[model samples]
Target: MSRVPRIRFKGFEEDWEQRKLGELADIIGGGTPSTLNLEYWDGNIDWYSPAEIIDQIYVDRSQRKITELGFENSSAKMLPEGTVLFTSRAGIGKTAILAKKGCTNQGFQSIVPYSNKLDSYFIFSRTEELKKYGELVGAGSTFAEVSGRQMGNMQLMIPKTIGEQHIIGVLFSTFDRLITLHQRKLEKLKTIKKSMLENFFPQNGEKTPKIRFSGFIEDWEQRKLGEIVKEVNRVDENSNAPVMMITANDGFIEQSERYSTDNAGKSLKKYILLKRWELAYNHGASKIRPFGSCFALTRAANIRIPFVYHCFLALEDNPEFLEHTLNGKNVENQLRKIVSSGARMDGLLNISFQEYTSIFIRCPIRKEQDKIAILIKSLDHLITLHQSKLEKLQKIKKSMLESMFV
Candidate 1:
């Protein structure tokens, strides 16, 4: 029996032919122009690097463009519109088809089909599977790199007819488009929500916000955060709460979803019982997010947070409004004022609990706060919906690619 893909399109019975990539197409290597040469700097020519291939299957433009002189002076070659660009070193498995004529840096082992016989889309799909072999044969003293020769020698199970290859390529391409569309929508929704937050809340030293609901003309009252909320450090050893992690982006998430929860012989009494609607702030600092972060538990499940997190209860207040404000820049600067004047080796900020609670915050009455929070929360729901659709489409495409190829 001839070796074949697990799945096949209708009216296709011929087995795929096995051919080495070098025998089927000419593999072209790329290079960068000298940075010292000012004459070869920025121009109209599209110059591609591995970094530009992120979350995209087809590339019509490059993040950095080069001059014609740059392209000529370097080892870069002007590939045709259908050429397949595959990164060989950093971001090893990133692949994209050229939507227009372009030249790539030395990071890629691009393929120029000898004739129209090889479908660029099909080859792009196969590039994901070739990553394993590339890693196996790659060699370098400092970092692993796959050479053009190795890529050329890689074997591919090519379909007997171009018609069959087109069918499979089109199917995967459609799914990729849908995923990309949803991803763009999710980003746009988040951006809009951020704009709304900035306008709905008062800025530093400003008594009134730029935008507000009807009939509320009273200036927001300024008071110590401790006046409205009190610190809570309740610990329960026998509590059946789900162990959770307070993240910068996702707020409170189950510990098992992101990491292993193997606290061997550790006392559960040390873990704080985090009730729903309570606020938790991580004092740890990192390069990405300085001054730490805070979030209110919006999840339905009552979870147990680590003792390191500062937990507090909001009394006679809108929890969602507080959470939304904490996520904004207005509260970030207020929180920074109370942080101790020192940075830990691991980037943790030294924040005294007493000073943190004493920080002042300005807020409107309960009715206005509730209105703003409800509006922002609705946008969050829409973003989440789009994100779920994007993930589902990506998974479907991945499964199809696996079964459609050898």
Candidate 2:
């Protein structure tokens, strides 16, 4: 009996054919040239390693180049532009369609698909299945590696018609382009925000910022954190609000999302209540925010934040403005001085609320504060919108991968 995909494009109706990996394509391996030979090191040839084959759908260049003499001496062989470059050693099944002719190191056991039977993009899009198959059959004492023979022995379901394969390949190619576009936009927006944060505020004890709105010529006033914000210790003992924690990138997210299941039981009532636009300091250290992170509850509803977080309310300042300002390098420097070395064992910073509130902050007048807060808040909203679009696009591709493949 033959098998068919759950979903199909218009004007196509046929069960997918079963084929061994070798029948559909030739599986090949690569090797490195002698490192001591200077002749092999740098040349016009595009030479790739397993590490270079990540996230990208098509690869046209390599970090390091090799000469024709290098290729002749090594086990490495040229893979055509349309070949699917698969990493079969160290990290098996990472794949990319070669944008141009290239050769890789020993870490790859790439596939040269037959033009009449298989599509490169279609095969690359279904790397999850290949990864699973590699995991089952691969064996090595040091690190798992799939030989050419083992990879060729693997089986797959391929559409009988080359037309169907082309359609599927084109579909995935479009998806990849869209995902890459959104990702670049997201990164660009974040870069802009970083620059704005640096330039919009005073730096190095300077009274004036490098960039400012027109008609605001007065030097900024220096005020203690105690004067600009006050700690909020309000706990709702009987509250049914959702438990939350601060994430460096996403701000406040559900505690359940972090731990997967309701990890907060009897400790729920002890959680501090954070109202709209109120801030909380998460002292847990992560590479993204090494000195801890401050986040605000931008959502309209109030939620219960972990008691471990130092909660704060904006006093004589715009809430969003204060929230953005608290994450600056200046604040991180202050945090570094106060964080005890012993706290490193627990992945948490040790700094008292009194000491945190005593740090000095320079600020403009009320009108400028409101303007800065509104501008920053708008950027956050725009970022959230783009983020949502990117997530939805990814979800669509994931769903398509499941239903469109057998």
Candidate 3:
């Protein structure tokens, strides 16, 4: 009996036949040219590594190129365009079709599809299934690895007609293109925000910013952080507030969202309670926010965070402006300068509330601050919207991949 996919395109109602991968494509092993040979380096051939196979549907070029001598001298064979480059070791099962002719390092067990039977992208779209299979069957004490023989021997259900394979491949290719487009837009927005953060505020010696709101001619006033904000010393003895945590992305999120349940057990009463529009600084450094991050409670009711976080309320300064400003590079620079590398308290910063309050910051008048805050907030909202859409599209693509292929 033949197997049929759970979901099918219009006018495609044929049962798919089970076939070994070798029947559809020739599985080929790859090799790397020695780095010591100067003559073998930097020629016309594109040489790829397992690391290069990330998230790309098709690879046209490589970071490293090799000479024809390198290809001939090493076990690496010149693969034709439209071959599916599949990594088989260290990080096995990453797949990308060759948009141009290429050869990979020893880590790859690439596939050269037989034009009469297989489509390069048709195999590429089955990446998740292939990865799962590789993981299940791979063997090694050091790192799980699947050999070319194992890859070729693996069985798959494929459309009997080559036209059906092309349609499925095209559908996924379109989805990937859309995802890439949205991802680029998102990155562009982030870059714009970074530029704004860099130029919108005054530098160390400068009194005014490089960029400013129209009609704001006055120099931004310099003030100590203590003058604009005060630490929230109130504790949630009643524990009525929802426990929250400051995240690098997504700002303030409830405790349940971070950990399936409210992991704040016995120390619930010690949690800090923060009202809406108030700010909290988590002095825990991460790669995303190296000097830690501060966020204003723009949404949600009064919430409790761990006592380790420094919670504060903005005085004359707008909470929105202060949130972005403190999280900006200017404040982060001051933070980096002050952080004592030798002293650390449980992987969190050992700096005190008093020290944080003493940090100096330059700010424009309240009106200008409000305007800049509005723009940044708008950008953040747009970013969030696009991110949500991208995530939804990815989920849809994942669902389709599972349903449309074996």
Candidate 4:
């Protein structure tokens, strides 16, 4: 079917044209200088490898530079500022527009657009789909790759007028910037939370935190974890219960996707039911966290977690405080102290309920603990809000890509 975009900018009434990429642009290939030659290694020109082309939308700088002598000796050619750099081998499908002149290894097949008929950003926006096509026609024994001849013959559907292409490119670029902004904000918030967690809690030998909130001047009390909470060992075959798994970094998340159906058969009885205000800990050792991770459930009463996780409820201490305290660096250090030398093949800690309860942890009074948890939780909420916005923008961009191009 011959068609145009579902959505178009005002005054763009003409239908888009379908043309082979080779007819619309000049295709260029790249190569590397001899590694054995020390003189050919480093100089003033930007040199990129397939590994260096990652999630970046545009690339201006490279990790390594090549000398003019090296460039003359190698098969690599200098691509212009607006050239679209696409990896055709090894790490296939990765693409970026050059913000400045650069050269890449033989792994890339770049495109230099004919500006009179094509817009660079417009070509850049289509690189993702082009990557899909490249993958389809690609062939290899060691790794899949699209040849330069294959890439040139690939077809592209684009607006007939350069003005329309420019408009569409700008619109998608704006959305990309918004997503990048939100992602940066989310990362900043997480870094702040990590910093605060370290500083808000006292060190191993200290009686008080380095930074304290106003009106909380007294030193924190040293309390055995056993003195604060008792392990809850309860389970039932309530098939209606929501199934969840405790992740080392992401906390509790639904594991329903792992199951074939909602009716999990006899396996449902093996699951542990957790009530509201309870704590769940992944007692398994992981590469990221040797002692595992723990978090308290703030959701309503019907959540069911796997039996692999150790469940506990606060009896004397504040539940919210215990959750954050255990996740903090000071308490994590305490956990590291008590872990048994022998870990199970499945990675579960050999430390039993008795050993976990006997571990000592430092804590502030209930009033101060509550205040700190509230402050940190508020920051978490803000981070979540921005993350959601970023996800939404990315989804919109995906939809636009589907409808705006043939």
Model 4 regions lying over 4 Å from their true place? 36-41, 141-143, 235-243, 257-263, 267-271, 285-287, 329-351
Clashes found in each candidate (C-alpha, N, C closer than 3 A) = 0, 0, 0, 0
Residue-level lDDT of model 3, residues 335-370, one tens digit each, is 988877723757688678888778888888899999
* Model 3 TM-score, all chains together: 0.91
Winner on TM-score between 2 and 4 is 2
Model 4 clashing residue pairs (backbone): none
TM-score of 4: 0.89
Error of 1 at 19 (Å): 1.6
Supply the TM-score for candidate 1: 0.87
Question: Model 4, residue 376: what's the lDDT?
Answer: 88
What ranking of all candidate models by TM-score puts the best one first? 2, 3, 4, 1
RMSD of each: 3.1, 2.0, 2.5, 2.8
lDDT of 2 by residue, 1-406 (tens): 4388888999889888888989988888888999999999899889899889888888999999999999999999899989999898778888888999999998888999999988888888888999888877886546787888998998888899988999999998999899999999988898998889889999998899999999999999988888778789899888777777888877888878879535767777789988987889888887788878888777757899878888898877877777777888888888888777736565677877887787777889989989988888888788888899999999999999999988
When 1 and 3 are scored with TM-score, the better candidate is 3
TM-score, each model? 0.87, 0.94, 0.91, 0.89
Q: Which model scores highest in TM-score?
A: 2
- Specify the poorest-scoring 10-residue window by lDDT in model 1: 260-269
Q: After TM-score superposition, what is the CA distance of residue 134 in candidate 1 from its true location, in Å?
A: 3.5
The candidate, 3 or 4, that scores higher on lDDT is 3
Candidate 3 collision pairs: none
